[model samples]
Target: MTGTSPKHDVFHAIADPTRRRLLHLLVDREMPVTVISSHFPMSRTAVSKHLRILSDAGLVKERKVGRETRYRLEPEPLLELKRWLAFYDRFWDNRLSVLKHLVEADDANEPETAVKPIKPQAMDPLSLD
Candidate 1:
């Protein structure tokens, strides 16, 4: 009910590929629904629905220019997504570092040996013996 919070979060809004593509399209510039729909294979109503979801998530802003409505990327909500991903990035980095250390330690403890290749015995293609 409060205007401070969005009806949908950034994650839910971007879950659909169509909505994600809409964000990419609106990133550089604002475009009306008709112009935006032209880039997609669906009807204008479908694009409008995606835009509505993005608007509810605060990922895009809509402006009224004369008779047409234009949409553009807001970008601020994406900071939450970036922060969430960053935590996982650091987590994986630490895990990889530990794994690397373990592998190197194991390698250092192994005895070095010359590897010899085994040769196959000659056999006829039709022989079952």
Candidate 2:
């Protein structure tokens, strides 16, 4: 839902869970339509449609070698997502660092105590009011 750009369209295209899975499958291995469909319970046509969406998004690329159309993942679009995520990653790291310092200081102020068995004190319900 960001501004339209080449990479923005690519991110939108791969936003779907199914499409993302397809990209992951194609990451290291180039797979055919039938091979990709077998990993999913959906029909071959449905898989093909998802592949088409990924292809349109530039998250994946397809090539026809003889009878089978092979699909491969394109990582260039993902770099954008990683870059966006990196900012948040650094932000959280700094926040956690401050928290760690506060927690260490707190632990320094408190000494560990031996556990003592507790006897339950009976409270009269009449006194609760």
Number of the top-ranking candidate, with TM-score as the measure: 2
Per-residue lDDT of model 1, residues 1-129, tens digit only: 787999999999999999999999998999999999999999999999999999999999999999999999999999999999998998899999999999999999888987679999999989996
- Where is model 1 more than 4 Å wrong at Cα? 102-129
Per-prediction CA RMSD (Å): 4.3, 4.1
Q: Candidate 1 lDDT (Cα, whole model)?
A: 0.95
lDDT of each: 0.95, 0.83
Error of 2 at 95 (Å): 1.9
lDDT tens per residue, model 2, 1-95: 44443433666876789888888888798998999999999999999988887766677888999999999988887887888888899889999
